[model samples]
Target chain A: MRVITGREAVREALREEMQRDENVFIIGEDVGVYGGAFGVTGNLIEEFGEERVRDTPISEAAIAGAAVGASLLGMRPVAEIMFMDFVTIASDQLMNQGAKIHYMFGGQQNAPFVMRMPAGAAEAGAQHTQSLEALLYHIPGLKVVMPSTPYDLKGLLKTAIRDDNPVMFVEHKKGYGEKGEVPEEEYTIPFGKADIKREGKDVTIIATSHMVFKALNAAETLAEKGVDAEVLDPRTLVPLDMESIVKSVSKTGKVVIVHEAPRRGGVGGDIAARISDSEAFYYLEKPIKRVTGPNTPVPFSPVLEAEFIPSEEKIIDAVMKLTK
Target chain B: MELSEAKKLKMYRDMWRIRQFERKVDQFISRGDITGTTHLYIGEEATAVGAINALKDEDYISSTHRGHGHAIAKGSDIKEMMAELFGKRTGACKGKGGSLHIIDTSTNNLGANGIVGGGIPIAVGAALALKMQNRDEVVLNFFGDGAMNQGAFHEATNLAAAWNLPVVFLCENNQYGMSTSIEKAFKIKDLAKRGEAYGIPGVRVDGNKALEVYDTVLEAAKKARNGGGPSLIVSETYRWKGHSKSDAKVYRTKEEEEEWKQRDPIADFEQILIEQNLLDEDKIKEIKNEVDAEVKEAVEFAKESPYPDKDEIFDDVYVDREVEL
Candidate 1:
């Protein structure tokens, strides 16, 4: 076992996958000698050569489109968009081309690729900041994955590379520096499985990405208040682990879904709806609560940006509202 | 000049086939047989035939909205192409892809895209894939001057040259981008010269002359296969018909249309072959009859084919069944 930062875990996972399969290669802006915009691909060029760790021009559409074509033709191409906001520039390729290719071609062809990008408001302005998981995952053919811990990021990314489907591996700009335990031996975490980060009884808090840590912190605080909150992290959104979610809800009799994305059409809303839809609905003692970013864009001001992201206090407030 | 007699015959057949296919499509659409929008390749026969002829069946091609010629020239069966347009279940893409999205994976035709310049990036990726595997394959991306303004063109061009990927950017300069003339859209006349920005070679050829386009593309393909990187071949051509069957000739004059019509690619190529003793009147008549019959049967097949079943609509999205679907 080894302790590593989330950033190191990403690089290690890429390195291991590239070693395991020659068909797997990385391509994106500054992914080469520059080591990626966030240094997630550190020194990979030196080991894998420029061909495997290719540097692309500032063309997000081409980057995504090329990934689609490469994957369709039997190569596993992992493309990186510098920021999630820029994913809009490559949306046609991702949504129209990558997502629809498999179905449009009658299963005769598909683009097995991974589109990696850092999302959420990380003190970045309106243009560079966005949490697009809900928007992208809503597509029928795409798999949306958000890894909270170092071990999960490494394991899930490896799985994404191996899967014969297109996956959007979304990361948080702030989470890369966080450290966690990761085994040196190879492993993978299957999609649609929920991780019970903490066990409890009073209430359940369903969270993803940055919100998972926020909910864990809220759970710790709630424990002192005798609330005994359970924290559930559903790593993959497309293949949602409703089994674990509904089970937790049935046990706790209350639920609070947390996410950094907008509340209007975020995955949190879907999770809440599913909880109400399941047998857990009869077990519920209180209405479902959601801690989310407002419908407005993540602003430029520090105070505004801080308020835009859901805090531990917000999570605790939501949990307290449901539990009380 | 170095083309064998058999190759010459193929070149003539391909060019003639595209022209005849498009002619039938227009007639079908006019008679209310074929519904939906279509961008015909009536005058741009040589560009597709010549460029596609220079490519092997294994070599990939990405075509534009006006891509029937490229598809037919790439040896796509007229039956499936017509079936696709007719929205029949027996189409190349199984009816999901109508006229704008005809695909023939058997020949490495990666479907014609509806979005202008959309296919170029896909072609660049195909080339990048070959380059990654050390596979000796080249990609021919056919677009138009209309696509000249599309972000995809610039992005694909830059990526192709930057990676030294084996791809040829074949621009079909039909002088108009859906009624807006190329001169109005660009300051420069030679669309091939745009490749200079990416540090690649760019050359324009007479698109009406199938052999000339074939020669240019052949040279470009050889360069690509040898790892010489990408080149831009601008085939200066015209769209003798309107952009589609829906278009009216309000933007240009009848005089200009007639002027370009006199230099029809089929007539010009037929005369060239006759003078070179590669074709005679009897041989020409036989080829014409064969082409006409093939197109006629293709239309009849398309008309007789069944529409896709309602349940089949749910199929083809994901091979592994990403979800319960």
Candidate 2:
């Protein structure tokens, strides 16, 4: 085992994937000699050469379209849009073409492309800080994965690279430098399998991305107060591990789904509905709770932004309400 | 550098095929044999035929909503194309892409796009792949005059020029984008001049003249194949029908319509072939008969093709069965 940051995990995945497959190359702005904007791809071009680590012009549409075309002609291209906001410019290629090519063509062609967008709030204001994974999650034919830890990032990134369908692998910018122990061997984590971070009998906390960290912290706080909270981290949102969530909720008799995206139409609502509609609903003692960001743009100010994202205090409050 | 008599004659026949096929498609759409609306390429036949005829079979091309002409010119089978437009099970896209989205990977047509300026970057991408693979194949991307105003066009051209990717941007300036006239849509009088900003050669030509458009576009295609980078060729053409079957000629004057009609590409090419002594009247009549019979057969094939099975819907979502791409 080796200690690696989320950024290093990403870099290792790129290196390993590029080494295993010649057709796999990365193209994006500032992804080459300048490294990535977040340093996830630092020093990769030196190891792989300029051809494999392509630094493209600041044209998101062109970069995305080129990836799609190259994918069509037998290339596994991973495109990194500097910020999640920049994905708007390439929405046509991603939503219209990338997401619909297989279905529209009646399954004749496979769009084996991965678009990595560094998303989530960092007090960077309305545009740069928005966690827009919900927008992509709404689109069909796209697999959405968000890894909160270094080990999960490495494992999931490997799975995403080997997967033969188009994937939107979103990375929270704040989670990049966070370190965790990752095994020094090649292994891919199966998608749609939720990890039970902590087991408890009081409440089931289903969270994603950075919210997983928040949930784990909240669990620690709850433990001090004699409340054992079960924390579940769903690495992927598209092919959600609803079974695991339902099973956990069944044992605990209460659940709270948490995410950083706005509460309206967030993944939490879907999880809540799944639990309510399933056999797990009979065991529930209280209504399922959903803790999410406010229904507004991410604020630039640190104080307001803190209020916007779900925090340990908020999770503790919600858990206390259910336990009381 | 002149096109041979046989090639020029062949080009004329191809333009006629587009005209007749489009007219038939319009009729089929009106009769409800085809479910959706269609953008006819009847008036702009010469532009697609003239430009695509300059390319070899291995060369690539991207088309727009008004794309049947380009598909036929690039050698897509008329039967499968007709079925595709009709949304039949045996259609080029297996009934998934009706009318505006006919795609045939076999001919390297790269599918027609529904969005304006959508194919520009795709063409550039294909060219980039070709350059990286050290292939001599050139990509021809066709769009309308209205698409010239889109940012994708400017960005794609700039990137293509910077990297010296092998591509030719063929703009079929048929006067209007839907109901919006090019005069109202753009400030630049000559669409080809837009390429000057990217430091590439640009040419404006009479799209109705098959030989002229063919020769000019042939030169551009040759330059691309030889690694001379991208060129923008603006073909001044006209659409014979409304933008789609739903449109009425409310935007332009009837006199303007009559004036463009007088320059009918098929008629003009037929006269050129005859006056140049490339074809006798009997041979011209025979070619017309052959084109008509072929179109009829295509419509019949589309009518007879079966719809896809329900289970087929889940088949091609991912290349591999267990993993998503």
Candidate 3:
């Protein structure tokens, strides 16, 4: 029973996994002596040595492709693409090779590698701040993980490392400093399972990554207005827990999906479509609403940036509109 | 580097096997027996067979789109490869990966990549894995002259050189990348010189000469295995056929093709074998007949194999897991 920042939770997961398995090594641009751009890999090289904690050139493709190749040879590589936006540079290796290797090779081999991508708007301009889980989730052979809390981050990251498929582990940059209680003992959360942060009946608020916190706060405000909101987090997007999503919506009869990603072709659209297509279609009392970032790139100005990200007030407004 | 008679004969047989196999593939494609596209490795047999002959069975290899020769050189079953091309259940990748993506883990062949330079970094990674585990093994990475222009080629080569990973970067300069000639792609005459930027040793050899390619690769592989780091070797060769099944080959003159065809890798090596008394007329006839029979059997096996079950279309997308998607 200890409270720690989300960053520390990530480091702990990595250290524990590295200690558990020798094949699990960290490779990225600044993951070595520099301790990562966000300080998530601080002092890991000191413990794991430079060999295990590898420092590569500023080559995202090589980092990703090398991880894929190493994973095929029985080594579990945890590759970090410093920012989510830079994943585009490594997209071919991650999407074309890593994601398709297992399937394309007819299941004879699998690249059991983890690519850690720090995402979300942290006042950085468009290039450095973007949630790319939607892109990864669209790929068939990849598993996408986005955790909002320190406890969830530690458990889910450990699971991602052990997973036999390519995993896109998206970490919210803004939530790195957020603190939450995590147990000292070892545990791992399974993929495709939903975590109901707050249980209610009037409406279901489905959120991902940093948006989950806003949804939780909005549920608190909704309770004050005498309208109960259920908060559900489908932590892993690829093996999405549609079962839990439909079950929650069946009881609430209303749903509102929220995320920092842009509205156009966002994961929210997919979730909304799935809900409407599922047996829960009859349970909907109102059209499923989405509170998401606009289709434009993330702005740099503080005021515009604040307006860009989904907020607790916006979630409350969506819930109020549905309930009213 | 004196090669034994047995080794010489094996390399000769492997080269002929690739030639016959590629020729059969051309016939199959023309006859509409195989759908989609395939990059034939006809003229480049010496490069694949010679370089791969230097590697041990435990060593790994990463191949390119035109990788049938690499698969055969690495000792993959031709039956499985033909079946894979036929999209049958008993194929190398269970029909998931066709000609361009054939993978045989049993022989340590990393799947052939569809992207030009995509397999380079993966091969580097495999070498990195070998180094991390303290294994004395090297990975032979096969790419084309066209791959030299790809970002992946630079990134992967730099990483391999920096880490001193046990890998040999073999560039089979087969003249053209689809329709674009290497002359238009690279400013430099020798593609091997690109290794200077990465601080790795580079060598060039007559890819038409199987013995020369074998010697060059053997040396590079030994250097890599000794922790000396990676080497880049440019095997100057050509493709006898067009880039793929759809290519009409309008870009090059028939005279140029005929000129290169005269320096055929198989015939050149066959001449050497005869001169050394390692092979005679009877032995030459015997090898051709044996290779032809093998190709015939492979085609028959592929024809008799059943297509993958329709219900299993969703299979092999992931390992050990079933999803709703």
lDDT by residue for model 2 (B1-325), tens: 6777777877878888888898898888889878879899988888888888888888889899898899889888899888888777888878887777777878888768888988888788778778777888899999999788888887778888988899999999999988899889988898888888899999999998887888988899999989899999999999978999889889988999999999998888888778888888899889899999999999899888887787766666555554322
Query: What is candidate 3's CA lDDT for residue A263?
Result: 96
lDDT of 3 by residue, B272-319 (tens): 999999999999999999999999999999999999998777886777
lDDT of 2: 0.86
- DockQ-based ranking: 3, 1, 2
* lDDT minimum window of 10 residues, candidate 1 chain A: A101-110
Candidate 1 per-residue lDDT over residues B1-325, each given as its tens digit:
4878898898898877888888888887898888887899988888888888888779999988898888887778899889988989998888887788887778888878888888888889999999888998899999888887989888989989988899999999988888899879999877777889999999999999988998999999999999999999899889998988779979999999998999898888888899999899899999989999999999899989999999997787666654644
lDDT per residue (tens digit) for residues A157-251 in model 2: 88888887788999999889888998887888998888998899999999889899899999999999999999999899877787888889999
- Candidate 3 lDDT over A1-324, as tens digits, reads 889999999999999999999999999989999999999999999999999999999999999999999998999999999999999999999989999998888888889999999999998898999998889989989989999999999999999999998989999997799899999999999988989999999999999998999999999989999999999999989889999999999999999999999999999999999999999999998999999999999999999999999989999999999999
List runs of model 3 lying over 4 Å from the truth: none
In model 1, the runs with Cα more than 4 Å from the true position are A274-285
Instruction: Assess each prediction's global lDDT (C-alpha) against the native.
Output: 0.88, 0.86, 0.93
lDDT of 3 at B261: 94
For all the predictions, what are the DockQ values? 0.65, 0.49, 0.82
Which is better, 1 or 3, measured by DockQ?
3
Chain B TM-score for all candidates, comma-separated:
0.97, 0.96, 0.98
Q: What is the total number of backbone clashes in candidate 2?
A: 6
